[model samples]
Target: MEMTTEILMSTMNTTGNGTIDGGNDVVTLLSQVSNILILVFLMISMGCTIELEDLKETFRHSAGFFVGMLCQFVLMPLIAFCLSLTFKLEGAGALSVLILACCPGGTLSNLFTYWTEGDVCLSVCMTSVSTAVAIGMMPLNLFIYSRVWTDDKAVIPYVNIATTLVSILIPVAFGVFLRWWKKEWTKYVTRFGVVLAFILIIVVWVLFFMLNPTWLFAGWQLWICAVLLPFLGYGFGYSLAILFRQPHFKCRAISFETGSQNVSLASTLIVVSFADSPLFLDMLFYPGLYAVFLYIDSFIVIMLMKGVMHLKKRRNSANDEDHDENKNDKIGLDNEGMATDQEDGVKVVAMKQIVADNSVKTDEEIKV
Candidate 1:
């Protein structure tokens, strides 16, 4: 049976009280507040890692940055839209995928880049540039892609998107200012931001269980989104870089940057934007699941990168060994040739001496 858009959107109606039609008002309030705080912390911490030089460096090598942007804004969103259509997700499930695809590369990209021995500077630059660009691109991407599938543009929370963009930029700019003013304090402040981020992740975990314990078994489409989204990002990201002939390290950086969406930001947007919707309970559950799978998929990518590096190292070492063995064999042949020449010279010298002795002996016999 096909469900109508109105029925899907009406899953939750607003009650006279501050709650969703059937959800608890207190839970909704708590989730929004927590989401705001978490987004702030994650954005600020992400900012701390960016320096003015990193921004300039992105411009210095604008080609690579633009390539990364292509991957971030173009390839990923298209992949997600295709997946959404494939899964035939409706309502929140569909929106969740769209929102994630529109999000910029996460701070986790930098960490993964370092783990994979990628160009950290490029990774940082890409992350910062993408985040800043996302302020505008996020909305545009959603507007363009979501329309392809759904006609109800009202389903999109445009105001929340603006709010999320402003909220994210302010804290991030402030963090960057702090780093510029007191470089010494960036470490401590960044550490604190990380702690807050972790706490927020935990809050999300708890909310999943406390609010919607049955989400895991609700739908297979969500699982499809959770598993494929990040994998596609990683695959397409690396492929794009290689296709463009980007250096290997930069390729790795872009791969991680593409795959790791800012879960914290996505969570905040989902929680706050959908807070008033009756479908909040049903729709809000997918972001957390997406987060869980994104990380898992990224971890797998890291391990694969490590494994590739290990194999490359082994192959290089084998090549070096073969080169050395070839050199040794050449040296041995040269030494053998030198010994043969030296023996021939010695024999010639002895024969000349013998001829001179015989000539002297014949002269002495003539004198006698």
Candidate 2:
């Protein structure tokens, strides 16, 4: 687990440098292929685990989901824009930030929401909806933003779009369908999917490291951005939830959803769209920093949530014990009172019988 985590961290950090080498191209390609396959398998597994009922539940919370989407689509991008202006980051840096903002929420949101005792169903639904929207929104947002900020024109590669559909959406739909048609298969796929995902993530990171050893120590600006952006995202999300009077759990979920951008997709887009340019090199920083911040911050948040949950459980257990003891004591006192009343009544009846017998015996003696 530790080794896998380290690899993921490395892959996330290797964003700007094209650290991948020609010698390791074959391995990287294989790893990317494997990653895609694993993702498909995981989606299938998710479909199996998700009942129609789960979807219904998710839909019921559509209002909350829409609110979250608004945060991602409207609020976050605006913030990114404002940040770009404040930082005076034009050209590649500005475009990169915009690209990060435009991309939808990713798979990690579900994990983080679950970790924080947030609504997993809502997170999943949001991911699906955001991904679907990204098909159109990603291109539009990038094109407009790039045009405004840089000389570079944004183009969404059709091949990459198709690949995304095949790898992500098709598999998810298939998984959902399989879950309804062949329930048992879904379970098997989900289990296998997890192992596959871990392996692919590891391979990608390893190849990244092998390709760019120096980048491992470089990209301080990227790292800083990564750390700060998520923190800002969470803060904004939580504040919005609080202002709206949303529940604590939902608040946590929204915070995570807002903060965790789709770094993987962003990285892929940068590679495919800007492979030749030095701008592509700069663009790498956004996803690299985003990934690094996400893993570290998420770990801390999850651990804190776990600790809080443990304390809550202990308190609840203690309260239950106290309630039970109080109920038992009340029952014992009631029984004792009933027993004393019965004993007094018995004594009174015995005394009455004795008086009657003595009076009858005295009458008989007088008659004799």
Candidate 3:
């Protein structure tokens, strides 16, 4: 719902004039264009992080890749749906949570994976695959699940989602070309993309909430879901990966992938589908809340992972030091044993010389 804010304003129009505002159309068009551009820029940056070798390696050990998809597409949506039921969320609340779950991993997941020193290649690849698959999977999930919560006959904005995904790939393909052809510039381009992506997110949110402060006033159940869902995702994702025996880096990447949803896309869908409906106001704000909580929770995971990695490093260093000390002690004991043997042999030789000299003296005296 790139144009959600404009839709929101128009929907909330209290003028009761029954006429559409001209200014809103301009705002909607601008927002839509800017959002698409931001996504393209971010996706391009994510694409640059992909390496030819990593792609080959991903195929070599494809278990982790499949696990990532399962966690993102299967487990996450299930978590969201279950949470909605458990919390007894009805109407727009249930729909909002479902939308978040159905969408693919966010572009920011790759960014967070990099920050956490995770498997960036796997993160990016999983995100790209999930997004491509979401063209079908997203609508399917909504179709199946939306019936559970309401009889509103939800509309899936498949065209908008498809257009967004296709546009995303165009920039990504270009970025990949840059990576392969102009390898020298890949580092700079990727860095620039990351920075720009962050700035865009901040700018978008600040502008959004600034204009609409009421979004921050959601119900406690929504807040609870927002906080609970991401944490559950991180925990389950990490545990599942460990059960599958994925390495630590891959686990972290998957955890972030599972937990950090593409909230921007979710918001876009809500805006596109429900903008003019009576339920628009109720559903529109939760995605922003989800974004806020996802970042906060994902950051906690990142810090915890970094701490564990540090402790592991320290323990390994301590073990190496202890091993070196034991080796040195063994070498010293061997040297001492060799030196004692040499000393004993020297004493035995001296005693033999003394005995020979004494016998020679006695024989000379007897002859005289």
Candidate 4:
């Protein structure tokens, strides 16, 4: 960890800037195309999971929905900004946290929410809603937070990103249309999207690491920020849900939605916006780490929640058994007490009879 920063800088500096070239670079164009396609499919996939009725119900009881939105739009961006300041990050390192934090929740969160026994409807809606609003939210956040926090004056291309976000929403709208018109096809689309997403993640991971090996030695600041961003998001999100008095299942959904970000989107943004930057690989490092670490965190969290609930149920059953035993013991003692009272009554009767018999004998002697 101590040498990570030194290694990253020295390694990248020695190897020149990066292979991404500029905006017109062939690799950059290919990357942008790929990202757009994947994002469209994923967005469509996400939209299919949401029912029109669920969305309507979600809006009707919008407390959880609003709380989730607050966590994603408000808490997450602030967390990223604070981390940037705390770690004293600059340039790509600073953008690493900011970009990941700004991107919408990932599709994987729905699956995690399901596994965690959360409100699947709420989870799917929150993810979809966040993405739907990302066009406005992402740019607004980056605009507000990026300037003050990042010491390096790396160019943040706002217009291009806004355009990109608008373009991405088309497929999601189409997917919703499908859900409304041909409900049966939505399931098949969803399954295909899931498979495609996993394939994309694996392919990107392999290709990215292969292209830039030394990012494995990225600075501790990047790693720490990556870990902290999602963890804090989950904690604060769940806390807010509790504060708002949401149910347990709803809280888990909100927490996962809050914590899980779209790494694919963030990486795409980095590739599209910062391809010209000298620190492209460095910018890529944090999102990759976040993807791995947070998923591990999710599994650990899911198992812990399941285990904790199981233990609670067992303890409750044990207490109930003890309560039954105590009731039975009380009934047995009451029966014993009744038997003792009956014996005492018999003794009293016997004494009375003896007294009566003695009195009769005295009367007979007096008469004689």
Candidate 5:
């Protein structure tokens, strides 16, 4: 479970205060290495579950997907930038927020969408596409934002995009290929992938909490921002869907896709880019807040959708029962009419026979 900022910060302060000195270069290096390994594993697991059919379906709804992506990649970053200016967040906090906004939707969005009766295919599509784009866009966005916000020139660390291609893209392609080749294996892989991703997320979050305790206590504002940002993303995405005259389900799906940031990728980027900066530790808070927010929001949305679906099913069941009762009544009336007709037919036959016998007896008497 992703710990709420309050709990994490408090726990960090109380427990992990002197365990590992933050000033130690070796510890920071270890943290970065741990984050990278976990990220690679998580990405690979996530990739294995992605089906080509799902991606194809996502593209089939290209207009909506594109629009939602634009909002996530473009509009969201702009909004975060504006918020940074308004709030005057400097150093790690400002960069963290900007990076968080720039990050694409998480792979977990598919699960949430499925839970909420949204389009899972679309969510998966958006996540994969956005993540691929993020390989380039993440560094570029950070550089651009840093230049505008800070007087000191910041260097965005060089990431091996090719390594991402190998680790993330290749694995995902292989997963999709496997789906095409052996569907049964794909099912098992998807199940395993889900479990693996969850475990990795838990481990990363725990390590982060262990490293930074202060972010847990006075981090109420970060928590608030995290919780609110996702809701805003969802609301804006939903509204856009409505504007596009999309169906209710598609609207909901797009909302989820827009709301859920790929925090795993964001965390990895932070570990890679800002491993040395004390100010950059705020990057840890960005994904930590997101992980917490996404968990809560996904649960709430899923429950609400389930409630609505349950009510709809109940109403439908009642209507079906009424329809069945009406059918039974009609069948009963028809059976009663059939029974009456059979009795009337029998009586008519007996009466005709009696009249014939009487006529024959009268003719015999006249002959006698």
Candidate 6:
């Protein structure tokens, strides 16, 4: 939603009745600029992780991406629909949840994939393919899921979708080119991009809650649903990948891709779809919750991955140290055995010499 300059941006200055305050044009512009900057930087950071080889490696086994699409377009929308029904939610709440559920995997998933050491190329591809697919799937899922509660057939936010695709693909392309051209700079760009992406995600999170101040009081049901959808997506995607026996790294990538939705896209769709409704503001609530919770869970998952990696590293280091020490001890023992053998050889030589001298003395006595 931070990237949606048309509608989601309006939420930054939204009054109590869903109208964006016209007076804060400067703040809005700055927010818009920062959002774009964030998008470009993060996309580039993601691009550095991609290479022709990774792409070939990714597409070589198309199962992971295919499974990702199934999770994004199929499982997620169903989860949202089920959540809405399970919560007995109606009005904007149900619509927003379902709309969010239908969104493509967000770029942040790619970021998370990078952090988790998952298949970055696979992640980037999934984000691109899903966003493109959402042009059709968003409305289709909205039509299928929202039919129960609302009469509005969501018009695909063509501008938002187009802008999102261009914004994503171009920067990523540039990053990919930059990577190939100045290979040395890829690491620097990647590091900067990762840090920039992390900070911007936090910024967006704070901005959403700040803009929608009442969202904190929006109740636990909406909050729980926000937490549930992504995790369920994660679990379902991961399980599906394991069932298909995807590589471990690819599983993490697929899991992150499935769980993370383009809530920004969802917000854009909500604005286009519900802009005229009386409950427009209410409908906007769920996406914000989903965004924040999705990120919170992302932080948790990444930290856990880091922790596990750290433990493994330490274990390997200790094992290496122990092996080195054992090797040194063996070397010392071998050296001591060699020294002892040399000493024994010298003693035997002396004994033979003495015996020869004795024989010489006996022969001299016999001659006398």
Best by TM-score: 6
Candidate 6: give the clashing pairs. Answer: 1-264
Off by over 4 Å in 4: 1-55, 149-212, 279-281, 319-368
Candidate 3 lDDT, 1-368, residue by residue in tens: 13243455454332458775565455545555666656777777767877778788987998888888888878988998899998888678989999888888876777788877788878877877777888878877888888886666556666656665676667777887888998889889878877876776666655555444566788889999999988998899988899999998999888888888876578767777786767778997677678677768877887988898899999999999999999999999999998999999999999999999999999999999
TM-score ranking, high to low: 6, 3, 2, 1, 5, 4
Query: What TM-score, over all chains together, does every model reach?
Result: 0.72, 0.78, 0.82, 0.65, 0.69, 0.83
Residue 150: error of model 4 in Å?
Answer: 5.6
Native-vs-model 4 lDDT? 0.72
For residues 1-368, could you state the per-residue lDDT of candidate 6 as single tens digits?
24334456566466789666765555556556667778899899888878877778777889988889998899989988889889888677888888888888888888888888888889889988888988888888888778798787787888777888888899989988888888899999999987876676667555554455666767677988988987898888888989988987899899999999887778778887778888787887787677778877888878887798789889999999999999999999999999999999999999999999999999999999
List model 2 lDDT by residue over 203-276, tens digit each: 66666555444434534544555666677777787788778777777777787788778765666666666767
Cα error of candidate 4 at position 132, Å: 1.2
Judged by lDDT relative to the true structure, which candidate is superior, 2 or 6? 6
Which regions in candidate 1 have their CA more than 4 angstroms from the true location?
A: 1-59, 149-214, 271-280, 363-368
- TM-score preference between candidates 1 and 2, better one: 2
lDDT of each: 0.72, 0.67, 0.77, 0.72, 0.65, 0.81
Residue pairs clashing, model 4:
none
RMSD (Cα, Å) of candidate 3? Answer: 3.9
Better TM-score candidate (2, 4)? 2
Best by lDDT: 6
Q: What is candidate 5's local distance difference test score? A: 0.65
CA RMSD for every model?
6.8, 5.2, 3.9, 8.6, 6.0, 3.5
lDDT of 4 by residue, 260-360 (tens): 98775676677666766676767867866776677667777788878977898899999999999999999999999999999999999999999999999
